[model samples]
Target chain A: MTERKLIVSRRKLLRVGALGAGGLMLSGCDSLNRSEGFRSLLEGAEDLHKGFQRLGGEGALAREFAPSDMSPVFRANGNREIADSAYRQMLAGGFADWALKVDGLVEKPLVLPLAALQSLPQRQQITRHDCVEGWSAIGKWQGPQLSRILDMAGLKPQARYIVFHCADRFGSTPYYESIDLIDAFHPQTILAWRMNDALLPERHGAPIRLRVERQLGYKHAKFVMRIEARDSLAGLHGGKGGYWEDSGDYAWHAGI
Target chain B: MSEAVTSDHFKGGDFVRRHRLSTRIWHWINAVAVLVMLMSGLMIFNAHPRLYWGEYGANSDPAWFEIGSNADGQGLVKIGDATIETTGVLGVWTDSEGVVKKRAFPGWATIPSNYSLADARLWHLAFAWVLGLGVVTYLFWSLLNGHLWRDIRMSRAELHPKHVWHDISEHARLRFPTGAAALKYNILQKLAYSGVLLVLLPVVVVTGLAMSPGMDAWMPWITQVFGGRQSARSVHFLCAFGLVAFFLVHIAMVVLAGPINEVRSMITGNYRLPKDREEG
Candidate 1:
């Protein structure tokens, strides 16, 4: 009877010990997460990845899939619709009057209406959109090359980053994103006005969206209102160059 | 205590250098790195909680596997048409704070102990550099030092079915190698180590790279080899769990073979071989 009691108590002790150890570990990790210095050490890995990603030519193009390979229903994410009065009015009129303002550090500041953008040279390719959340979707995006537009508005010597000020707002702050010259001038980088052989839907960033194919989905700013070329990303909202990057502490360079 | 007994070259029953400095260093670093990577990777997986095949997969698409909570808040892991309840472990669990969470994989099993995809990615990518570089350097150093060929590489004789079966049966019976025999790895050990080092580690790294959109531009063939990005992700997930399974078995083996002696061998490179019971 005493031996049986000992066996049961020993098992209970073992169970308690295991749970205690597990709890310690979990809390230990949480404390580490709270440490600012440790967080920086972790974030420092991004520089190594940035260097590694740049090893291949900056002009490298993401893989383009076949027509049938496109997702049947490309899931729309983030801000699907804008409740802003101006944005809603533009959407109601089929974005006919909407014009993308190209300014800041450019030799020529221009405002090209939707019709004007459609008149430019258009290139369409089916490419995969990888989200930071770890899902992927393929869709054919058609638009004039961003490089062509950049060339038309001649980038200034100081201009290094291209910022897209989007129409939609997440709670009050408008959605915005920026890319360095390498990605800004990428062949696949375009202000897409059409998706899957149809005009861009409101849910999928109507009028236009920036498709920086090589980067993650969050880097691809939707419902773009203005394109501004700048020397640096500093002094912008939260100064991280992208809405998600600023708000959620997402990596500015999301090539992965 | 006699001076001879404590001396490095002391006359003893059986004391030998079992691990190289390179192997010991890499082993410990890899232990921490793999744990961090796996935990953080689980947190990342929680964001989607679904797995699919082909180049594209999203919420609307049919996933071959998923972990989610039904409307009743009961955690369920679904594989095709089959469903398994995973309550209090995956899909739903009470965190240490006593707050209920509906995320796939409990907080205890994930890094940060809370939901933060950004933080998880930070931990994962950072250690990925360590893990990636460690593998490359270890493999290179092992090859140069003859550690790969002399220790891990299976001989033709050892690869024979009879030899492998003998090792397996002995292992099943908990009859580990004794004295001098303990110095050299048996067929089962060789196979397990080589499988992890040569096949599993390399496959996980390549599959991880395949998931990168930037890598698609530089190495399109990688995605093709895995069938698609999602397929590569599935392969990555499987290989990670494979490593976890190996880790469990490895820990069990260490415990069964005498934890103190086995752990000390890896740490100090000196092993005290198990005594031969039949000799007595």
Candidate 2:
């Protein structure tokens, strides 16, 4: 009788113990999941990633591939055609009369014509375009270094975030993006006017587009109309530095 | 533990030290990190909803793997050479908002429990750091503390085909070691643990690093190692799935071997062995 009673009690013990331990295991994870301390820890990880990436600096260069290695067809993402009337008219005229205005917080507020941009020293690179949505394509981009243009414009002392105002609009607001001086001054950052050894197509941001090579594709603003430098992005369209940032909650620093 | 186990001793009323305190701590820590990573990762995968082979993959190109809804609002998963319908579960389901949509993974299984890829990334990245750092630390600690040398590495004799096959058969038969034999890890447990710690985790981390453009700039070969960024992404997904499989098997082993003893050993570092006469 004692042996049978012992077996019965042990069975109960096993059941209770398993249930209790399993419940604790799950609830522990759940509690941590909901905590602010956990969130901060996650943010700390992001900052660490940013800091580690910035360590490479100007010395770092994105991998450039042979022209033959370019994807047979590059995917055009987000706003292939803009609804802006001005963009339509500019597209119709083949961007002949279009001028990329370089103003705002600059010593020399100059307007650069498409022909003038072509005349500048050009850098052609066949590099991979990584989108945040897990797709990638390689295309040869030819454009003058953005640093060269920024140098020509002569950035003011207060200049910090370099904002690219594009002609395309998602809805009521115009498509735009921004980068810090680190990316703006990088050799790979360019206002590309040509792709795959030919003039850039409307589907892939014709006339001119920003190419901050180290970042995800969203930072490569298309249909660039104006370049503005500001101390902070507080007053920008989304106050988060990009259109996707305002609407989609995308990270402004897409170095990852 | 070697596969050439000379005997099977499953008995009760014996207590043995199964897991070291450090192992238990690391195991549970990883449990949280891995679960968070997998859930958030599913959310990240939803952003693309397609997978392809080779260097570049997009909507225009043919995908080897895809998950989406059909015209009739039914979910479907398409793999190379096969297409299977799985609605109310995978591709199409009701989200947290109680509205039915045809997204790749439902909100119930994702971090943030919504359609926010940005927030999902935050969860994934945060846990990634935890899992990565914890793993590195545990590995180094185990090595220095002689845990790896004393326990994990299999003997040359165990690597023999016949010995290994015997262990496989025993596991298949749901036969577990008890009493004195329970003090050590079986061949299968050793192999599974070592594979996860030494092989799978490192592959997952490196492939993830390869997908980062920042890492590519520092060392272009990082992405090139797997052919390209898209390939790296595919490999990352596969590896995460591998880890999930490992988790499922690990849980099943714990339950099958007796959840009471397994859970207690992990929590308290003392395992009370079941009787050898215990049924399979």
| Model 1 CA deviation exceeding 4 Å by range | A1-24, B1-12
lDDT string for model 1 (A31-109, tens) is: 8888999999988887777778889746788888899898999999999988889889999999888899999999999
C-alpha RMSD (angstroms) for model 2:
4.0
Q: Candidate 2 residues A159-178, lDDT tens each?
A: 99899998877778888999
Give the number of the best model, judged by TM-score.
1
What does candidate 2's lDDT look like per residue over B1-280, in tens digits? 2222234453466566667788899988988888888888888999998987666778877888899988999899999979898998889898656799778988767776667677777778778888888989999998998888878889988888898899899889987766667767777888988989998887788888888888789877777888877778888889888999999999899889877667767877767766666442
Pairs of colliding residues, candidate 2 = B10-B275, B10-B276, B11-B274, B11-B275, B11-B276, B12-B274, B12-B275
What clash pairs does model 1 have?
none
Task: For model 2, give the interface RMSD.
Answer: 3.0
Candidate 2 - CAPRI tier? medium
Q: Score the docking of each candidate (DockQ).
A: 0.53, 0.53
- Please state the error at residue A145 of candidate 2 in Å: 0.4
